[model samples]
Target: MNLRRRLAWLPLAAFLAGFLPATPSLAAEPGSENMLAHRAAYRLKLDSVRDNASIEQAEGIMLFEVIDACDAWASRQRFTLLVGDRDGNIVETTSDYATLEAKDGSSLRFSLTQMTGGAVTSRVAGEASVTPQGGRIRYQEPAATEDELPPGTILPMIHTIRSLAAARAGQRIFVAPLFDGTSADGAQDTTTIISGGWLAPQPNANFPLLSTLSSARMRIAFFERNTTGQGGGAATPDYEVSLRYYENGVADELKMDFGEFVVDGRLGELQTIPSPC
Candidate 1:
């Protein structure tokens, strides 16, 4: 599925964005697909706030879905958050993000729109390619411009497929430049941390498909390209997401750290869609 999505503030949508992937071709190998095509609703709330933080309270809901479109994967996510500041004033923000990705890790189309107080604040839409020699990103909205993606750039779906396959194969971590079309930056260097090893099929009684799949716990951090942190090494990540993910690509129990405050996403609902395969 993907480490995918972004909210207007997107702190919520952003977490899911990390997990969602673009569409994969029907030729995808077994055990590397999205596994479960499903719609998920996550309830979000303040997990914590730094003492000096301006955000005193936060609450929101995220609606996300992934569809098996036969030849490719299609996904849509909507995030809305009502945040209260130290002054006790409330602000509402929302973001809508969507994508259609090829199954062979060759291409992707993405769109993201953000609004605050019911007015559009920002929008970005584009198409990108993935290849061994690097690819190009052609932005079609907000402005007409093109950028070069660094060599070895992988889109979300392929990144997830490779990551999961590695984890299942006993590899602990891997770093890659990921281009999900979520930000203006052509690609962000991502470091994925896998933990708890690979799990056995514990079977979720609530979701039939989950009952047959093994799972993993992972944390992924997104770092801006060419940026350095305090010690002159890699810069601190802009955001971090931790979640439990199933082999079929279903994710639950999420933690999103947005610097100012942290939010948690609890899966309130899940329904798997039938795949054409």
Candidate 2:
């Protein structure tokens, strides 16, 4: 993937929200106001390189925010990366991604903008709806086009809820297609591998919101639609993320695989916002 495409996903402080269900119901009820409304800062640095990817050194920061907007969840992610190629050429890439998801998980509004060398390269803005027949997206910024969402598709927060449910239910693996409108392509297939069962409360006095919640270790692989898990063995993922997911919706010790290189995103600071209900 080119830098523009990579930016669409590489550092998703997305779902910047948190959730821990009382039971393994697997249903998303955004109106419950269980999601943590907070902002998190992550320090990003190169963890490894692969395929001879050009990288003298790379560093970045990702700022993530999730707000409870009365009847919906609003999230925004700001990411900036400075990369030094083999010959000492420096390129700065940045992206702003934002979304508004309804309380019922029935609708979503999304926008993503990417820049490289201070020049705008891509912009994707759209609205989508989930229905019994499936989902459809209507793009308004880049162009006027409509796309179909595969059946059984889900939005990001619901994906988190379902994954948590499956994890709590002792299911080691879960597969689903997700549409967050981060890219022009409507939905991407995902395979979530639960590394272990629930985690006991790990004390964190500095971040009181996550102090007493259970957590799970999960690794998720994102793939191009219909390119995986059918006939041949599992195809390589376009992007992969493994993290320590807390019941309160905080993810720390993030390892993001960007095809050519991997980046680690560790939480640096956190503050919870009171619900404005």
Candidate 3:
């Protein structure tokens, strides 16, 4: 299954907002007023993805909103995802609602809502049983079969930002991308990276205001190669992934332009999740 298809379990609209510009940093400087009041929203535009076999193009729209924030303590977020094709016809759309609160040391309570299709169907709802080691997020729910409930929903994009904030600059951290289990393909289509670079401080802005603060250019791509089974395997590919955080790192605006993919011989998938206007 493709990355976007696997991500379909959760609301696709929310993740697209990660492409927007970065927000001002809420961390206060020495002797400076505590201007790090936490709260932010982001709007983003969905890009196009080409299907190699069908030669079809898919377009989408995404919105992300940070309902609550207390820096490293806790946060609440919501997202909406919509997808279409070259002719501007609606393909599929849904929404995902989530909340993250710090539990014990290095642990958190993760919860989510599953919305499917354009009609906003309520598939299932659940929380994580136990936090993964090293602050990693490890939660799963069964497939949305007629007999069983939908898999444990997750917000991979928000978890990425949370992982970033939990660590100090120059420190390396491993973030487990959101996985619904049902979409795990034989090719091991997962990507990982070590990102820790300079970020400009965000300017002073009135709380709950929408604005572009800072921008950073970074690299994101797949690492390990698949070699065990059939099909092309074992050659890692590289690409450029740029991300912009808004509202003082409470939200993100991301842009990932994969020049090409090796195994599939097709372009990478790009989508946007924006906040409600």
> Which candidate achieves the best lDDT against the true structure?
2
Worst lDDT 10-window in candidate 1? 7-16
Which residue pairs in model 2 clash with each other? 18-249
Q: Which ranges in model 1 have alpha carbons more than 4 Å from their true place? A: 1-30, 203-205, 227-233
TM-score for candidate 2? 0.88
Q: In model 2, which runs have C-alpha deviations exceeding 4 angstroms?
A: 10-32, 227-234
Cα-based RMSD of the predictions, in order? 5.2, 5.0, 10.8
lDDT, candidate 1, 1-277, per-residue tens: 0122334222111222443455456465345455557789999999999778888888999888877765566778888888889898888888888777776767878888878878887777888887778899999877899998877777776777767777798888868877887767678777888998898988566667677778888888877775442211156886678887777777877888777788898888998778765
User: For residues 1-277, what per-residue lDDT tens digits would candidate 3 score against the true structure?
Assistant: 1233322222111211222222233452221121122333444344434345321333343333332222222333443434344455544534454333221222233334545454544332222222232123333433422211112222333334433443325444333333222221211223334354435555534432323343232333432324442322235543334454332343344554433211111112222223222
Q: Could you estimate the TM-score for every candidate?
A: 0.86, 0.88, 0.45
Off by over 4 Å in 3: 1-39, 51-76, 103-111, 114-116, 119-124, 129-168, 171-196, 202-242, 246-248, 256-277
Q: Scored by Cα lDDT, where does model 2 land?
A: 0.74
- Worst-scoring 10-residue span by lDDT in model 3: 261-270
- Please name the candidate that would achieve the greatest TM-score relative to the true structure: 2
Give the Cα error of residue 50 in candidate 1, in Å. 1.8
